[model samples]
Target: MTLYGLTAAPVARRLGAVRPARARPLLVGGDPWAVELARALRSAGLEVLMWAGSEEQRERIREAGLELAPGELLAAATGRGARLEGITAVLLLTDEDDFNALASTVLSRGAGIPVHRLGPRSGDHGVVAPYGGDDTLLAPGLTRLGVAHRHAQGAHIVTHRVDTTAGTLPDRHDLLLLVRPDGRLVPADGRAAPAPQPGDIAVMRPRC
Candidate 1:
């Protein structure tokens, strides 16, 4: 069973990388992930509008000097009276997974923009397609190298099939749950565990 590495290139091609000039991502909710995402997007020079769910959340975001979305989707129109059509992309970063799914569906149907969710959850969220490229700044624990804060926050367990034909191995201090080719979820602690073979699924939250 040979192992392969999955890079941002292939995923970018498949997901159609968002152009900076055309990137207008609407962030939903007031979660830490949403805050970090907004910061990252702005750092990249993209326009961002946020809907933080409550007045408190909105105030917090405003204090941070970010733009806020309208109270309701019906009021979400551009200066020229165009509806959500101006939105290039939508990101659902709420803590409620169900709410995220519902909002994503609504935005996709109404705005016709690419919608993405933060972590793995139910329903069809765009992260499954790995839309963001290497330049996409993400909250910790979403990627293999995001295990820095695991000690304080505990690890975020993520389940995914190895997209690469060559597969990958767990680094030291990381935990892995290998779903064998025959469909077995086996736990392997860190470096002691063997490399995941091709076609095998892995649940990895690296300690990096």
Candidate 2:
């Protein structure tokens, strides 16, 4: 495995770069926005597995009609076990920025499953930061809890199908996730927001 330090998660990528279409995603941590995201992803027709750090979170996940991640997955994330199975990707959404960063390390080590998390607050650039901890997701300078608070304030996630006939997307910089027609996700946040094109589902949220 090769480890690359990033303004994102700064994790070790396994031997290959071929990413599978995201059919099942494992969501780590149980924050208000994270729970809502899982609900949205499920409505979009993907199977989402929820894992919580506390029993309270577990109840919330269950109440939301979401599936909890397997028990063994906890041992794996703590660095005492094996790679997770079934889920193609992982999203670390813990409220603690450092905890999310640390979990990404254990989960990414030799585990081909792709991992993304909220950016750490350790840096001074602090434009808020986006979710790209593993360099997968992107956002502004907000911490995990900060994002949750934003969601409560009516910030939202929406998808737009690019159509040149109507001109280009108005705010490309606020982009978070880009889903290609083939189901591959292209990162389009941070300073390197990819140009939006037709036939792609652009998931966008505000910088806050």
Candidate 3:
């Protein structure tokens, strides 16, 4: 699916290049947002361990066809008896603010994992630091969540000029460019921009 012209294809490609090869089990705190995040993570070939708080939540997770584990089991999974290894990240999706905050602290301190938290706000907000800690604050709506994810993933925002008379850009034309770590843009035609060191934004307009 496309979100603000950012599709999974480009997002996945850029993510693949930067993401570690080993699959990590994402520990999700139970909620609707967690459910959706689990789907997206699984689609990216990552394992998910759901820690739902109630039977109703468990049933909802089961209906979604995902694996479920008790919240208590999460501490164990991240501990000695862990069946999975190389946990790359953690997602805190619980509705309760206190619970999510506690989980974030534990995951970061105990497992040394990067944590993304969903909060009760109106727009997506995030804080990323050089010390390997980041927080993603999610609002009430789903669209904002996607925007938040892309922003967290460090995707560059691009606005293309669409000719109202002729229509949008051609399918082969690059409407949005996913910026790389070195500041280069990746497109289908193998064209690259001048190296864009960090903090540079690239803008291009289609020829009339």
Candidate 4:
């Protein structure tokens, strides 16, 4: 199976190439993926703060000479009502899927920060970072996760969401499969277009 690098149309449009302040990515995990992600983020000119998963991991992080963030400290720093002083984005690379999901939810809800995941392949609706040693791709800001599935003939199917209340509605097309809040897929085929509301998912196969 071929895994293509993720490209975001909405995120790129929102964050134009103006080059904002350097990013400070918070990486949580102690695995090689976390280390590699840190290196990649640094190479991208982003400041990194790493959190070790255990005592063994702590030694590794320290040996790597990265800023070590403890669990308690991170919780206090990113707790509810805490101000976002300088965090650009968050990467949850834990081995456990549950912790990763919880951390993503808490951080996103508490500080309005976007969290991405690196390990544990499929399951949650979190941002999945494709990571290789010293060669990872992590874009700035929130990236809603999506998937591509094979379709009949030479076409491919892609799906994404517009769940956030403040999210902009993408262009409407007849091939688009828009899911409503009540779990119904609304097709853009010949019917009155539904109003763009919260909790809508759009699926489409880009015509090449």
Candidate 5:
């Protein structure tokens, strides 16, 4: 909230908090993987938004039928936009490792918002301690390098309902995100376990 918004605490209490019950995640990257994820989220009945630093990225993001976040990346993601409203979480998947780490730290600290970033390229030498591990931010093969390589090889993201009785989950697949029956959106980038109950929609990718 801005300085002016701070004074409206009593008014806010009467009106109600900004966010709704369901999750509205704001993706903070401009890759094809990000676009696919955003589309799947919307299809699953969650409102999704994306932020792109370049015009090329914005064009593709819009072409995918997603909305673009206004203002700069960190500012908008940190609730410094028009208002600290619907956005529930920020997923930082930019190719730049340092920028992702920096933004992750800032959003977690300043904004008090949940943040998830891509697996860092910096390893142990990284300036941010939390974003160092391959499994820390995202799953091993979901990083920019890994996703880019797979995208080039015809691997695409897919969303499906979890019906254990139908068959076992695919062997060579990675679970990216999960949308529960209650409209809770969960990111399964190794940060969260895959709890697939019947009738849940899962966002996944082939391990090819």
Candidate 6:
């Protein structure tokens, strides 16, 4: 299935509603991408646990004032009393494809944690499988999409009309600018909108 299909907006909306119940994510790897990812997750209000591969990388994270747990991803995930409780997501930011793939497989099977892989390359080989089970967030694509979507929906206030094109329904109009589903306006031919259900048409205007 496609990434958009895998990530249902409504599900994400619901998940975003309640604070994540899993422990803060445990990032595995010592690359520059891993450091940046830890910072980003912390900014998003999620706890970040770093598992560095080397002493130099560990020091870098320590100097940055973030929590550090010295262990590889597999070791950390498999350690006794290791529960993923409160982890919102798991990010595999390693440069090694083999490491990222193995981490993704293990997390999904072992802890049921959503795993995302970050790297500089892209291809079907890099795409995580077990289809629709876990999530993989690649560099640039996922991040860019998120940034663009946020920018598009960031206006404090917006006004729009809901014009109907069929069925004897009266034309409706509403104004909203909020970021949530209730206030945003989805246009015709918009791929971001939910899939159509029975009797749904392209010109149906959402009522406030």
User: Per-residue lDDT of 111-174 in model 3, one digit per residue for the tens?
Assistant: 5445555443322332311122235432222233454455456443333333435533434222
For each candidate in turn, the TM-score is: 0.47, 0.69, 0.46, 0.44, 0.77, 0.47
lDDT of 5: 0.65
Q: What is the lDDT of residue 132 in candidate 2?
A: 29
RMSD of 3: 13.6
Local accuracy of candidate 2 as per-residue lDDT tens digits, 89-173 = 7776766665666556655764476667767655653333333244535655544555566788888766677785662665633
**Winner by lDDT between candidate 2 and candidate 1:** 2
| Candidate that beats the other on lDDT, 2 or 4, i.e. the better one | 2
TM-score top scorer: 5
Clashes of each: 4, 10, 0, 0, 0, 6
Tell me each candidate's RMSD, in Å, in order: 14.5, 6.7, 13.6, 15.7, 6.0, 13.1
Candidate 3 error regions (>4 Å) = 1-21, 74-86, 120-134, 139-208
Query: How many angstroms is residue 67 displaced in model 2 relative to the true structure, after the best TM-score fit?
Result: 1.9
Q: Which has the higher TM-score value, candidate number 2 or candidate number 5?
A: 5
lDDT string, candidate 1, 1-208, tens digits = 0001112232222223333444566676664435544654554455777876567777878877888765443333222321333455666555554454444444444343456544432236443323322222133333322433452375444455665665765444343345555433343422245467786666555354
Candidate 3: residue pairs that collide: none
The 10-residue segment of model 6 with minimum total lDDT is 174-183
Per-candidate Cα lDDT values, in order, are: 0.47, 0.60, 0.42, 0.45, 0.65, 0.41
Q: Write out the backbone clash pairs for model 4.
A: none
Q: Name model 4 segments beyond 4 Å from true.
A: 1-20, 74-84, 119-208
lDDT of 2 at 145: 54
By lDDT, who's the top model here?
A: 5
lDDT of 4 by residue, 13-125 (tens): 22222322665656677665356445544543446777664777667878877777644333334342212245556665566544555444445444444445533344343
Error of 1 at 45 (Å): 0.9
Worst 10 residues of 5 by lDDT: 1-10
What is the lDDT for 19 in model 2?
A: 42
